[model samples]
Each structure stands twice: as C-alpha cells, then as structure tokens.
Target: MNDWISHFTSLTAAPDNEKALFNKARPVQWGSDQIIFHAGTPCNQYLLVLEGQIRVQQISAGGREIVLYRIGPGESCILTTACLFSHRPYPAMGITETAVKAISLPKSVFDQLIGQSGLFREFVFNAYGNRLTDLLTLVEEVVFTRLDIRLARKLLDLGKHAQIIQITHQTLATELGSAREVISRALKEFALRGWIRRGSGQIEIIQRQGLQQLANSEFVSSR
Candidate 1:
C-alpha cells in the first residue's frame, strides 16, 4: 500500500481503482549503484518510486557518460514510459543513486490505466514533456556552453547548502560530460582564485560569492 495516487497531481484514484492498482503492483527494492535498466534492453515494467533516487544517463560509444536526469520520490522515469509505449529498447541506462523502494506495474495494467483514466494520461504526458525539456536544455548546454562555466555552476549547485561537496573529480567530470583532466584543470584555476579548496574526493567552497560570480559569468570569452 504505497499510495501511488498521491504522486500524480492530475490523478485522483477511486477506492476500487486504487486498491486494484496497489494489488497489481510488485514492490521492489534496489541498493545504491544497482543497475535498474541497461541501454538496448527492453523494459519489462514501469516504475513508480516511493523512496530514494534513480539516475538516468546515456553513454557514448567511447565510454563517456552524461547524466540525463534523476527520478526521486513520487516520480517515474519518462524514458521507461516512452519505451513502454513505443515497444522499443531503452536508449539509456538507469541506476539507483541511493537505496530505492518502488512499485513496478506491468505493461498491461499501465496501458489499461492510461486508456481508462484521463487524469493518469494527463499526468504521464505532462511528466514526459517536462523531462523532454530538461534533455533539450542539457543538449544546449553541452553544445553551446563553455566547460568552465558549466563546471562552476555544477560546483555551486552541489556545494550550495553545506559549502562542501564530497565527490571525486572523475564523478564530477561524468556529470558535466567532460574528462578528468579538464575538471582537474578547472578546479586548479578555481583554487588559484581563492574560491575553493580541494582535498581527496572533496571540495570546500571558501568564497561562495566569488564562486557564484564565476558560475554566472556567461559573458566571459570562451576559448
């Protein structure tokens, strides 16, 4: 009884419908870093996350990975929804970022709900559209934005609350679609500027305002 209905803002399930859905869904748990889906594999079921985070990412043939987005509590993966509708293999990989609890709905039940419930349909489509927009934004940043600015923004985002981030350079590189050498070089520049201090798998934001300026420096000449 995960109360799946509350996750969708557009849908309010009737008592009977709610019970049916709850009974039909299979509860699943994934530990941190577990692969939920692999690229080129067909998705067997749609997932509704009840707890924790799932990271969706794409890997290039050269082994470079770029994170597309994350699905958290009360969220579902739009890519899996597309796979279910199109009857195709997943185009990217999904992994658990933390220990996750979810409910898996078989294709038949999911399709039935989509066909019978207008609110569910709306919710699904809206979620798909929002994720599509995020992918597009990521593409724009990767193609048009400078790496330094993107890295700065990413650091500010991660260290926003605690002013310290516990992550490896390679991990940060993966998130920004850059190489480890590039991230290391950029971090060195930030260090020289007295904005941040880097340690083993950690970064401390010493001058938050200065880092913010670097992160927001859109007009800086890109080399």
Candidate 2:
C-alpha cells in the first residue's frame, strides 16, 4: 500500500481514500525488449511504470515503425485514457526498453476511483495534459526541425548515460523516422568531425560539448 501510494504521488495527487482503493493493485514485471501491449489490442487496464523504460511506437501507412516517445519510471502508458473513454482499440504498441516493473489497474477500478475521488480526477487530467503537451512538442520537432539537427539533439539527450548508447542504425532510423542509410551517413559525418566514435555494438561521444553546440545551434551562415 505504501508503495502504491508513492507511485500515485509521483503521477498525481491521490487522496488517502483513493490511494487506499488502489492498495490491492498488483505489480507486473517485463523483461528487456518485451512487448507490454500491442497496437489495436483491447486495452483493459491502466499501466503505471514503476521502473525501467518503454518505447511507444506506431506503424505508419508505409509500414515503418515510427517511434512516438519513450516512457520511463513514473509515467503512465497511453491506455490510461483510451481504455476509459474509447471504444476503438489501444492506439500504440508499448515495448520495454529495459526490464520493467509496473502496476496495472483494472478499468473498472480506475473508473470507480475517478468517479468517487476529485483528487484522482485532477491527477488524471494533469497526467493527460502533460502527455498532450509532450506529443505536441514531438510533432512540432518533426515538422520544423531538420533531420541532422534532430539526430544531434537525440545523441546529446542520450549522452547523459555513462554506458555506451546501444542503438543500431535501423533502430535509430525508426526513432528518427528516416532511412537506415541516412542514419549511417549522419553517423559517418559525425565520426569524421571527431564528435563521435562508433564501435561494434555502441556509439561513444568523444566530443560531447561539440555535439551540444550542434544540437543548440541556430540556422546560421556558419556551423
């Protein structure tokens, strides 16, 4: 119950009563690269990530997996709202990037909590609002930012990890909505510039500051 309360607090303000109602929620584990849920599957529960990262990807009309976003600990999956309000199936596929621990609440329990608890309702609203903003930001980035700049920014964002960034060219292509050859070319360009060094299974950032500068630079006459 205490753990459940903590998880709820991280997501939104849950009153003591609402938290108590969720005390019986069970925790589920997901192995690395496991599929938590699939697109178009019937969404019966709300998933709250307690640990690890999950990738939300959508298949485009061209049959390519487009990375929607990554959700880490303390984030709720998209099915939270869809299961409650929509008749159409789950919208996106959720794949675990690492071993994951999450709590799944039955749709009926979630609806009961929402109906009986104002705090719970507010939490859901805030969570969805934040997710909406994130989606919009990603949309804007895709529409306005150049592919090279986006790749640089993504590399910089992943640089915070001490371990080598373990992503293949194909995976990078899917995440960036580009072709594998394009990602390979971009990596090659970065390597020639001495900003990054690629290895068999990972990419190491040799000049993180330069990468940051490239990520933050404006459209200008000089690089």
Candidate 3:
C-alpha cells in the first residue's frame, strides 16, 4: 500500500510515524450519495479522504440546507477533527457526493498521533486553518453578495468537469442558501439571455462567455 500520507505534501514523512499510521489506519469506502455522518452524532473516527468527495452541509429543521465545504482527495474534514478533539457530536452532517475512499483512524490512535507526530500536528492545524478561511468566505458571500452573481459562479464551477450539470433548482437553492423560486428567477434571466438551457434536473451551458462575464462583474445588472 502506498503511504497514503504521501498524498498530503504538507505532512513530512517519518518512518516511525508512517508505520504507526499504516498499522492503525483502516481503509473504508462509501457509495455515492451515502450519508456518512449526521448532526448530533458522535464522531468515532477521524477521516482522511484518499479518493472522491464528501460534502459537509448543514440542514435545518424545515429541510433547508447550505453546503459548508467539500472534503476531497488529500484533504480531511475540519468538523471531524474538531469533534474528535473536543469530544463533541457533529454540528453538521457529512454526505458522500461520489464513491469515496478514505482512511479512518480510531480516536485513540488519532489522539496519540496528534501528540507525538509533529508532521501530523502541522497537517491537522493547516487543514483546519484553510477550511476555516473557506467557511469565512462562504459566510461573506451568503451575507453580502448578490444571489445572481453567486449562482452564475456556482454554475460555472459545477460545470467545469462536465458539459451538463445534473442538479435541480431546489438543490441549487440549497447550495446557495436561498429559496427555490429565487434561483429559478435568476436562472430564467440567464436562459432568456441565451446563456443556458435548463431541463429536468439538468443544466446545459449554451454560452460560457456569457456566464464568465456575469460571474466576474458585480456591477453588471440583468438589464
């Protein structure tokens, strides 16, 4: 097995630490769309994703949701780390967006490694700091940015790897923390302008430049 720790370039390799991690880290997998953790659930293991994506999100009692962040290859969850360290249940939920492969380190092993391994400690804190920054940015966007600009940007980002994005407006609203009707109205404006075409549960980009222009300028009005 490849020293999975190698995926994280920030973690300097030590033979002893690598050996210990290898012995204790259990490989795990989850199918796409699986719920990995829920709010108020105690975290039993610290996860380091080796492949695929796990989306961390917060869902409200009335079924509204806002995506917090995604944990992808070479990354770990800050929420999981916080839970492990603080002995607290998860504040939000983690669900697999795709088939996921990861290493699960038991809480006891994680505690010991965080104490003894400088590289491990550094890696943990750095990941935490980076995710914290991302969350802060998300907060800023949700608070002050216009929804149309965010929607354009989000569509561009989601369409990067695929020509057609498979998502519903309701899901997109959940992503942007807005009502479905608001997202539909924005999307209608984009469609009327010949930028995109929306179908059942799918969105196809008709003109990338149009979206690029909208996503880049905060001053550009729909008029």
Candidate 3 local distance difference test against the native? 0.89
Per-model TM-score versus the true fold: 0.91, 0.84, 0.88
TM-score of 1: 0.91
Steric overlap count per candidate: 0, 0, 0
lDDT of 2 by residue, 121-191 (tens): 77677878888888888887777777778888988877787537987888888888778888899999999
Regions of model 2 farther than 4 Å from truth: 1-3, 10-20, 161-164, 220-223
Question: In candidate 1, what are the lDDT values of residues 1-223, reduced to their tens digit?
Answer: 6366566544555447644764687889999999999899888798988899999988889888888899998788989999999999999999999999888989988888788766667777888899899989998888878888888899889987887899999999889887888899999999999999999999999988887886777654354
Which rank order by TM-score, best down to worst? 1, 3, 2
What does the lDDT read for residue 176 in candidate 3?
93
Looking at candidate 1, the ten consecutive residues that score lowest on lDDT are 6-15
The C-alpha lDDT values of all candidates are: 0.85, 0.78, 0.89
